[model samples]
Target: MNLPKKAEDAHAALAAAFNTGDVNTVMSMYDVSGFIVPEPGKPVSGAEKFEEAIKGILSIKGKMEIKTVYCLQTGDIAVGRSEWSITDGDEVKVSAKGIEVMIQQNDGSWKILIDHAFGAEASLVA
Candidate 1:
């Protein structure tokens, strides 16, 4: 299906918010009952809870860059993959892969059902 622009925009905004370390913005991307798969170091479930879980990483000096937004919609359910990288100052902290599952609400807005982030490994920049 050709997913609506609003849905695509929302996902894009989510990526921006997440990369910028904006707690409120990031939290805004989820539904009340929405869930997250939790990167290896993060906790699962609840928007605020997941926000708190990522604080540690956000605390460390870094900038997040997201790439490859792959989305597919089946009825009202949408799933996407977000590939990301973290740069700590001039060094690359990590390069990760993530996936999101979203549900379209009756209001025609979208909410995330799952947000999972993880990496294959951590490598130091040469």
Candidate 2:
């Protein structure tokens, strides 16, 4: 799916930032009002809180893969469904299905207004 221009850039930037494990660059991609649903932790808002959260995730040296879904836009809001696999080296730390609701800022930058992620694991059933 083809994402809108800025959204596409944001998606790439987010992936690069994740790979770099740079909290600031990652945060730069988000709006001031953006938020994140952290795994194994609490939700984060604003820069300071977000930074702390990223630091923790970065500490694990995680990477994310998100496929840009050609979702429509309404005003400044856009909807997306992303399938993500996060890894700390060779170990799959978090496998997830996430929905990101994004909004464009005044500067034409897109940020995550809401993020909800689910954990994926192989269940042992006998």
Compare the candidates by TM-score and give the number of the best one: 2
lDDT of 2 by residue, 1-126 (tens): 222346545555566667766666767666657677766345678778777877776776567766655445788888766666678678997666656777887767777676654422233111
Question: In candidate 2, how many Å is residue 12 off?
Answer: 3.1
Question: Which regions of candidate 2 fall more than 4 Å away from where they truly are?
Answer: 1-4, 88-90, 119-126
Q: Report lDDT (CA) for all predictions.
A: 0.65, 0.64
TM-scores for candidates 1 onward, in order: 0.71, 0.74
Query: What is the per-residue lDDT of model 1 for residues 5-51, given as tens digits with 9 covering 90 to 100?
Result: 45555556665666777666667677747656555654377656777
Q: Give lDDT for model 2.
A: 0.64
Model 1 misplaced regions, further than 4 Å: 1-5, 41-43, 119-126
- Assess the local accuracy of residue 44 in candidate 2 as a C-alpha lDDT between 0 and 100: 73
The 10-residue segment of model 2 with minimum total lDDT is 117-126
